[model samples]
Target chain A: MATKLLSRYPWATSPFVIGAPMRVMSGPALAVAVSRAGGLGFIGPGLKTTDTGVDLEEASSLIDKARASSFKTLSSSSLLPVGVGFQLWSDDLSTAMGTIEKYKPCAVWLFAPKEGQKDLDEWSRRIRAVSPETQIWIQIGSLGEAKSILQSSEKPDVVVVQGTESGGHGRMADGMGIMTLFPEVADTLASSHIPLLAAGGIADGRGVAAALCLGASGVVMGTRFLASSEARISRGYQNEVVRASDGATNTTRTLLYNHLRGTYGWPPEYSPRTIINKSFIEHRAGTPFEELKKRHDEAAKSGDSGWGPDGRLATYAGASIGLIHNVSDAERIVRDVRNDASRRIQGLAAA
Target chain B: MATKLLSRYPWATSPFVIGAPMRVMSGPALAVAVSRAGGLGFIGPGLKTTDTGVDLEEASSLIDKARASSFKTLSSSSLLPVGVGFQLWSDDLSTAMGTIEKYKPCAVWLFAPKEGQKDLDEWSRRIRAVSPETQIWIQIGSLGEAKSILQSSEKPDVVVVQGTESGGHGRMADGMGIMTLFPEVADTLASSHIPLLAAGGIADGRGVAAALCLGASGVVMGTRFLASSEARISRGYQNEVVRASDGATNTTRTLLYNHLRGTYGWPPEYSPRTIINKSFIEHRAGTPFEELKKRHDEAAKSGDSGWGPDGRLATYAGASIGLIHNVSDAERIVRDVRNDASRRIQGLAAA
Candidate 1:
């Protein structure tokens, strides 16, 4: 019904904003919490690499429980939107699809697929085969992809334009920023008429108002919301985001974090935004991959917490992370996005 | 020949880049002077709002002299691409055409016109009719405006996407900044079969490289050039952009400088970025037109040296003004832009 409604009115608003799928932070409880706060949420299907013993089944199980909670809430009220996401390049598609068949998500967002394998047709068809209403929101790092999506037969229901300042794996070639990419995509794809959402360095309502002026109907904030109470991030991790500055975050495509977790075999182009810790600094210029592998294997067994400014773990954040300073409730973050936009708009009109 | 060649390939390396026509600052001397430096230049037939005491006779005399210099250089070397611009909203069609005939510029740039003006067709016809080989460039504030230009009959040879940080008048509707605005336009227009240039907030080569990544073929810098020895700004003024920090500048749409200089009659939606100062703080909110008029009458008679921060006149700069450290020659500015972009790109690639 939501799909039918969205298709009927392309310009209509949606209170249903799914949390951008973070690897470890967002899960079943987070999804339910966001829905309770009057917005949609998602379960991150982390990096589902083709390798064995990764245990994605746990996240899938949590979703089933969330559905039960959703069902109970819907018994008294309306159904809420919920979803999952995958790193298209690193993940195992067949196993992932099996979970999707059993527990249908409201949407599935994908990012950083292999250069030669942009199998949009197969991916779109498979998701729709299970449930045609489920949206396939693909994150694009450049305008070329935005145009390609508009022109492709497997047209995305919603396009997410991520700037270089985005926290996770992003495009290095022509990594257009969010500000220019949003409005230009909005103008060119006006004919295709898909709902556009901005996802990069957006922390507050002023960011939301700026996006709206540049042509987005709404925004998707990641690091900002990561500090929410419902998110499963460490108290220390959440505090770091609150304390970070625009100048503090360092971006790179290195596999330091993946290696530290014993998670190798990822694409070369996609870099993560993390703070410059001692370990990264020591090894960044070049540490023998063998030495890095040994260090990574030891750290994975010990748990990532032992790592600090001198640790191996990466702390991913967008440029807007500087604007955040508090570890507040998720509901307050949502309210800030709404209220700040209203303030700027009203301020301009009054002047 | 060079003019025609540049039209065919605007991004092709050349010492002579056409100086963008600007209200108040642009004049016959500006056009010819820039051309003398081996760069093409234009005379701004600013809107009726810009009262520089420049009559048609004076404008024609300047153009005539520039043409003589251009022809002398062209005969000895290659022809210079001199041009004129019109504020599309402020002037009538007859006036635009009459200026074209009397001054005979190689091209015409249009800016900030009312939507659906019938004069577009007339001006388009006159431009091609008089100088069929002449190029037409249109300056637009947003990507939506770029899309609008594609629909217009007179497709510009080059479309300048002017972002909010520009020194001149622009849509303050939410202040979507240069970082977001540039890439959006560049990526969207990459497929349009025209070369794109990034403008606003560009001070050096890192900016140029970033623009390239955002899909722009070139960059147009205004603020950095304003502080150059070749530029007509005050000696004290050049020192300010050199020593200022990013925090020193704030964007506002006040007409303080123009009012102090006795210029007015601008549209309400347009605003420009200005550095903050004491008098600006006192009247930053804005003053009544009558109150401003009274203040201007006194300042003119006294001939106040509006040179420093506390003076009534405002210093306009983009966010990147902090990068500047000295008032170098215009040629050095160009060299630095090329060098900085090369180093950043090299460093990123090397990393």
Candidate 2:
């Protein structure tokens, strides 16, 4: 399974690291940099369906530049090395398929379907039809979801088992930690020949090594990339990500930020984990939503200042934030994690 | 640190496994069996403080019998090979200390102090005074709790970082997954010389391998031990532990079962994760606690049938229940997990 997964991306190395497509934050620069550094990078879901096409166009240009430069090892396959993610329930299938038809990203990460596997089956079928070479990577949070996928007409080429510690939107009430969740999902889908990737609460090489021990062919990191230099984020939000510690207390799974930002209608079963700020604090302390919304709007107009402990903007992140101490380029992050994981794996073996 | 931890218990092997001292369930037979299997075990807190002394006396007899049999590897340290646990907030310290002084257990596992680290400091100091050879093992659920321990006057010889997915009592709100929590706590207390053990949702070899990769010197199993043939558990309760699946939905952290069992006044920060039963279902579905408690009392008189999907007895188990298929003796369970974990660790290193 590990060899099969690595075969899809020739430039990638072992203990495969992935820069998760973290909504708007994961963009062309980060994706291209990660792939150039022998790791897979994914462009997260954009604000609009057509925005994906724009990111792919930028990614194509970046890859072309990298090929002409030092990164001559970059794959020249018909499908681009970078992948793209979509929020199935909110994203328009036709528009996403159109983008995939054009760029033909190596993988399509499908998540948060309103009708679960049935909805995933439709999107998987459509996306595969549009881009035959592209792999379908479905993200599931629970074992039940994994079982449901097996019953679907279109099975994912890869299953990313996300634990409850994941950032962005995840299973609100039915999520377990990846430590137990991953191995169970792997055991259940062992015969399927689909490679499993562990996601959520993974910030560094220690997490990467741990994930591999849990039977993950690869590991996906969302929060760690939020601190990457290439992330498309506000200065304050980035600083907050760097400053946060003791994630158990600093981060929470809440939808207040989503509503405060006027972004509504996420699937009911999903909610985003974010760094706590004044907006959520006030809301929980008896401030009305309307009043909080007014304060959020005011905070947003103040530029980079709208993203600290006192800031009202949502700082969607994972519980692994405390482990991230500084910002670095995507390439460095990927290489460091890969090297650290290798060292740790070797060290544990010797011990 | 791993070497130091193993040196303290010469009978234990690398990737050390410990049977968690589950309340009443982890008794003399289970503890002695685990120790005999070359894994450390701790007798769980008893119904009363005096009951601990009774369990220890039985454990002494079991060790004597085992030594006369095939288990010649057993240590002859003045302290017993098996450890003992106590719930600080509710337990009488003088009584527990007296028991420890008599048995001289290899370790003392302390948990749920009413005043946090201060309470732990007092217990550690007193336990050390009573039995100097007994190692102090402190269980913490969050990074904040880990940080607080560093400031205490009495330092623990080992710290068990318990994630929220643990069965029995755990942090109600602040607990994060062990995948993230263990590494951060390890990084914070790197120079303390304390061996950090990963707990919560750990059942088999994959979990054990993962914890070792996360820098855990050892791994602890609480819920998994509940299914051991030697456990002091009812047949129905053991059946429920094996029957449960999709722990994300089947298990929850709630105090309803505790309150119904007439076990109250647990510190506000903690709650036990139990298999969902008729008692919890009705309570969540608007059934009054008074009516539920009445039904619970009647169900307790019906023998082992008091546990299951419809049973009202508290089935305190971790989210890893789905992975457990059957009951085995503590020795077999320990040997299987240890051997499997070693195999997986070696396999991952080669990969």
Candidate 3:
């Protein structure tokens, strides 16, 4: 079953490394770079549904340019090497389906559905109808969600089992860590033929190797990509991710950041993990939401300076940030992780 | 460092499995059974500090009986094969020190210190003074704790980096998953000679292999041992643990059970993860603590019937309870996990 899943992505290597779609930060440049380095990369949800078409067009242009330069990264000419992700709750399906049909990306990663598997089934069926060759990927944080997928009308080609340590949006209260979550999900879906991918707190080769040992066919990295050079992010935010240490103390899963950014309506069960800053500190210190919002808006106008321990802007990241020390390109990050995982696995066997 | 750590326990195999001291549930039989199967086992903290002495005396008698037979688990005459754990916040240090002086256990696993490393340092110094052959093992759930150990007056022989998925008393809010926590702690204490062990949500061989891949010299299992036939646990509790399939939905980290059981004074930063039952559900559903406590006390007299979804007793366990399907003897459990981890690591290398 795992081999069949890997065969679908011919360009990728063993213990596949995936660049998780982290909102707008994971754009065409980052996604293409990861894919080019023998890993799968998916463009994250955009500011607007139509924005996806713009990014896919740019991704297509970049792939064409690479092919023209004899890069030979992607062998399949008919399919775009990169994938695109969507937040099923807020994203427009028609726009996503239209964009998928036009670009024919290799995959469509779906997450945060409002109506659970029902929404996922609708999106998965429509995406397959529009882009027959594109595989469907669904992200789930709980075992119950994995079970629901089995009963759905349309099954996903791959399931991403994210843990509570994941950054950005994740299960609010009931999420289990990947150490237990992935294996349970894998055990339940052992006969389903849907390859399981581990996500959450995977920032380096150690995490990559650990996920593989947990029976993950592959691993996905979201926060690690946020520090990549190709990420569509402000310098301040990247710096915070690099500078941050002790994520258990520095980061938290809260909706205060979302509210401060004027973004709301995420499912009640979902919350984003971010590096705590002045806004959160003040909010917890009894500062009213309105006052914190005013400060956050003021910080947003300060550009890169808005992100830091003292900065008020939200810096979404995973608990693995402490492991990420320096900023590297997406391709190097992928290669380094893959090589490290191989070395660790071999070292254990030798031991 | 890892080799030196393993050499201390010559009878143990690679990927050493430690039966976590699970608050009176892990007794002499379970610890000795695990040790007999080439793994280290720890007696959990008892109802009183002096109770640990009683358990240690029993463990000493059990070891003597094994020694009288053909069993050759512990080659070292000076060091007892089994280990003992203590809750520093409540366990009287004098009583524990006296027990260690008399038994000279192979290791001492210390956790939930109210004064953090200060208490640990005191325990380490006194333990060394009393029994220099015994190793000091400190349990930490965050990187900060790992860092703090570096500055302590006495260093630990082994550091157990436990994730939030751990049951019993763990870091309530700042604890991270072992996937990220272990690696980060390993990176920070790279220069320190303390061998690191991964704990939390680790029920089987998959978790053992995953922990080793994440740079752990060994792994610890608390919740899994709860289902072991040798564990000092009630049949109903073991059945509930085996019956539970989804830790994310079936278990939670809360103080409701603690208060209901009339067990208080756990440090504010620590909480136990337990399988939810009628008492917890009632507390969450607006039933006052007093009312819940009354029902819990009433249910306690029902023996094994006091556990399960409808019962009111606390089923203290990690999130890995879902992965444990059966109650096996401790010796068989240890051997199976060690063999499985070896197979998994080899499988990854082959892949």
- Alpha-carbon deviation at A125 in model 1, angstroms: 0.6
How high is the lDDT of residue B152 in model 3? 81
DockQ of each: 0.04, 0.82, 0.86
| Residue-by-residue lDDT tens digits, candidate 2, A233-270 | 88899999899888888899998998988888888888
User: Is candidate 1 or 2 superior in TM-score?
Assistant: 2
**Real contacts recovered, all predictions:** 0.04, 0.77, 0.85
Residue B115, candidate 2: Cα error in Å is 1.5
**Predicted complex 1: CAPRI docking category:** incorrect
State the lDDT at B340 in candidate 2. Answer: 91
**Chain B of candidate 1 vs. true chain B, TM:** 0.77
Where in model 3 is the C-alpha error above 4 Å? none
Tens digit of per-residue lDDT, candidate 3, span B1-351 = 567788899887787888998889999999998888888999999999999989988988898888788667575546989999999999999989899999999999999998888889999999999999899999988877887998987999899999988888799878988888888999999998779999999999999999998989999999999989999989999999999878888888899888877788998989998999999888889998888888899999999999988899999888998899999998889999999999999988997
Interface RMSD (Cα, Å) for model 3: 0.8
- lDDT per residue, candidate 2, B222-341, as tens digits? 888888999999999999998888788999999999999899889999999999999999999999999999999999999889999989999999989888989999889999999998
Q: Top model by DockQ, which number?
A: 3
